[model samples]
Target chain A: MIVAVIALGLLAGASGLLLGFAAIRFKVEGDPMVEQIDAVLPQTQCGQCGYAGCRPYAEAIAAGEADINRCPPGGQNGIAALAELLGRDPKPLDPESGIEKPKMAAVIDEQSCIGCTLCIQACPVDAIVGAAKHMHTVIARECTGCELCLAPCPVDCIHMIPFAPSITTWKWTYPAVEVKAAA
Target chain B: MSALFPFHGGLKTVRHKTESNQTPIQAGILPPRLTVPLRQHIGAIAKPLVQPGDRVLKGQMIGQPDGYISAAIHAPTSGVVSAVDQQPVPHPSGLSDLCVTIESDGEDRWIDREPVDYHRLHPSELRQTIRNAGVVGLGGAGFPSAVKLNLAGRSEPLATLMLNGAECEPWITCDDRLMRERAAEIVAGLQIMAHLLGPAEVLIGIEDDKPEAIAAMTAACAGTSYEVRPVPTRYPSGSVKQLVKLLTGRETPVDGLPVDVGVQCFNVATAYTVYRAIHCGEPVISRVVTVTGQVHRPGNLEVLIGTPFAELIKQCGGYRDGVERLIMGGPMMGFALHSDEAPVTKAANCLLAAGPAELAAELPVLPCIRCGACMDVCPANLLPQQLYWHARAKEFDQARDCHLFSCIECGCCSHVCPSHIPLVQYYRYAKNEIWAQEKEKQRAEQARQRHQARMERLEREKQEREAKLRQKAPVRTEVVPHLDPLISVPSPTKGEGSGQVG
Candidate 1:
């Protein structure tokens, strides 16, 4: 038993040491590019992209996997600048994606409200605050400005109004087209 | 074909070609008018050379080429420029863009023409002349042919010039008709392209479904160093990349072009146009378009560019009863036309006037059942179900890690989705969302910079104010009060917000 114990102990010690050395030797270098991309991404966590979160999208951008134009929430400017970062020709927001328009959130017109919370159920991000057969109001700040709530209201009580652009939410316009650099 | 180079994974899509491909392509009678869009070719929108109230000859140039990458617009029939403003264009979005409307004088007269013996001219001179003739890809891609032919001189070392006759799209039969009717001209164009690229072997890749085209190409290419290779009809088989791989045994790396693989492919129609441009000195003014789907009498018609969809439909015997979806091009990857009034452009290959009985109406999208159907048919080897999930959930980052950008939006995912979900639409949505977020961030940075500059200006003003106050005291022996009554001294407030360095 003692002999077997010593052999196991030696094996464990060797493996532990090797693992420790590897951990020390191969530390990951975080890229500033990822951080820059992350700063650009809208952190709505809408999961509109296949990624788990916005950070993964940023990481993908840094890795040259994600196109800048994929973000509906980020809109046109996001794609243009992403084209800037990747040093590729900036194409218009692919029409395959829906055209970019001013953002608006669903506003429940209380007077027309039949107290049917159908709009509440349709709210993907759960920005609606109301009860069944009672008046509903939208939490504007939490809304992703998707306007999904407008469709479900049977009586058309829910109306979409344009959201004001804030300093924190604004983006730079696409730069003028220039000759492409060698990748 | 070598087993190592065999192309695979193609879907047997429904063919609605009986409506159009059965009849031989007919030349259309002269129309009352035509509306030519300046940006007909691949490059920038050409500048308008003729204005309204100006009379033009049949071959008059209306829109001049913007740059080397662009093609010029020509008058299809002798006409007067009625309008050169925004008109409804046949795009998926149904938006209005700049167009030149010409009212035909009904006299189909050709201007005194000049022809060039391309065999005697140098390759560079031939290419420049082809550009001047406004020859471009008659294929759906619409890339300037002169620009593509010029790439032969690049050190990439091209080995083959392929004539793509694989009209794989369900309803479009333009390329097939071009090969069937104008095979010799296409061959002449191929020889011209081969001369430019020198001793480059020509391979005409036609789908097996188009045996007539294959036979015609074979007969036309009998005396030359060209081979007509029949490939299996596949959705996207006509795509330049897939055709190249099928013919030359080369795979173009992602984001790289067919030229990178030592192979260059052109549409059979484009090749025929090059022949016409080189030999007859005739610029591309018209093309063959397949009018099919729910129309009463459907067939291919050689129509002039900028002719309204209404006119084409009228020539095709109009729509039958409840014509629902009007798609420009094939059902697989075509854009839905917004209205019947929109004029057809160079990119339009087919106009599908689908009714409820012929084409199914868009059904309500259900949750994905994870049946793995999307994966089985994805040409790009992507997990479309995962992409749909991320797109629905707005998890664009995860989609990116899964190579979302590589999803070519070919509509295969949407086509095969058992859930009836418009998967392509979702992917597009995800892409747009990600783009919007990036733009928002950029705007914020710009705003921050502007705010910073304003803060700096305020600081400088405060500093100057203090300096003046000190100077006044120094000049007035520490107790002197007023000097100039015209200027009143105002004290500054202390509250200054710190700026974020952009």
Candidate 2:
């Protein structure tokens, strides 16, 4: 019994060391750029970029599988952010993702909704709310401004208006301030 | 402001700077149509001051702000707003943004515009008028200048209005040229800014690399109280924090603004805009952008916010061949654009048409060797390698502890990375993952709240129905808990196949 136990212990220790050494030997160097490209991405899960989410897009950027301009949600800021991270020249956003447009959110007029929950089920972000046989409402903050909920609604009660910018949701845009004439 | 605070993380990558700074800043001729996006400056999307059918004069206010934080959008050219709908804007997402398309009227008529003579107005009045003119920080930060000028804080104004002429990013020459050519106006703007933010001295910090800019600025500020100081040419010497450190010898505390050290820095361009805003009745409608890189003709062109990249590129004689990427700013910290269709925004200082020949065909990214090169030049003092590890492993908790949020995404790490592991990309992914997860968590919490409410309502209604049923049958007493008959959840199988929870 002592001989058997000693043999088992030796095997286990040897295996552990082997595994540790293998990990260091086979270690792959990772690109640290994925994070910066990711930051410029819109946190929206709206897979408008064809990726499941922003992280996937970041992965593609790091992997060179995706173009930085495909993110419609991140807009120019995202593109600039990615360009900055990659040490590449900042470019215009890709036209394929979609053009930069006024952001909008879904709104449901309860008066015309007729208690249909069609939009509730269709919403990828679950922004549109209401149950069957009950009036529906839109949770604006939760809405990704993707406009997905509009098509699913059986009645034409849903409308996507221009996104209203409040103090909290607003981000600063660089001003076009021209330099002065030299004194 | 560096008091040797030992900011422990960052990388001083090879500053490529081979293209732009080499040439004397040149201006592109023939002004084209300028499509101005309404929400160019941050805050509320300004209401259109001009309609699609209305003929606007150059520098005309096309969009008016509804509130204080908002800025007015101006007509880049005296033309009709061709369209006032969603046009492709220069955003990373490449999504269409609200813009006023102006087909340029070749005349470029100067509408009754007057420049503010700063000496005539009181400092407070000058600030208000400048705010009314909608002048904001020309630096990429894009902070509202009015708020910065009117310091609600009780601290004595001890900082100098450091005019940043050090165009740190290699290919961007908008500020450098502005300093070189328009030194007097820039100085005048600086003087105005100083008067408004008084007790503050005027220190125009130009990089030693641009001796012409330094000489011009020195010449401009000779008779005025403003002083043109030349600093060592560093990659980010123009950064407000770094310049502040060089000038005042004070370190802005982490997570604190330059104002914390009783200092406020303004870009030289911003000062120039202040001068124009106070002097001319012009809102910040147009800006000078460096249009260079792999193009036939490259020069600095004054473009209106919302001018399409295609137009700008066309004006710059277009790309020579193999245009790989279209970036909105300099190579250091700009966006690699997807299309040439996106319009210029207020923030776009440079437009680069770099193809695979210059930008290079993207190679596969390797892994981080942990040489700690990224740590050497990080202005933020963040452990980028630690962040890279946590991000790759999806261990966001550890990344947060490493101060993931403070990373300015300056691309310093990626620039110095030997293995070409997009270090910044990893950190970005981690941050986005965490942010997405947070949003998901919030959504989940919301769903839970809704579910809980529904459950409570169901319970209350069940009790109410039971109470009603009691009035009908007093002797037979079991309250029916099944709500299948009351609330019918519809199923896809049609009305006959109802979702009944028994």
Each prediction's total of clashing residue pairs, residues at least 3 apart in sequence or on different chains, is 47, 89
**lDDT of each residue in B332-366, candidate 1, tens digit only:** 77878879888777778888897786564666556
Off by over 4 Å in 1: A1-183, B1-4, B431-502
Give per-model TM-scores: 0.67, 0.66
Against the true two-chain complex, what DockQ does each candidate achieve? 0.03, 0.03
Mind listing the fnat for each candidate?
0.01, 0.01
Classified by CAPRI criteria, candidate 2 counts as incorrect
Every model's Cα RMSD, please? 15.0, 14.6
TM-score of chain A of each: 0.56, 0.69
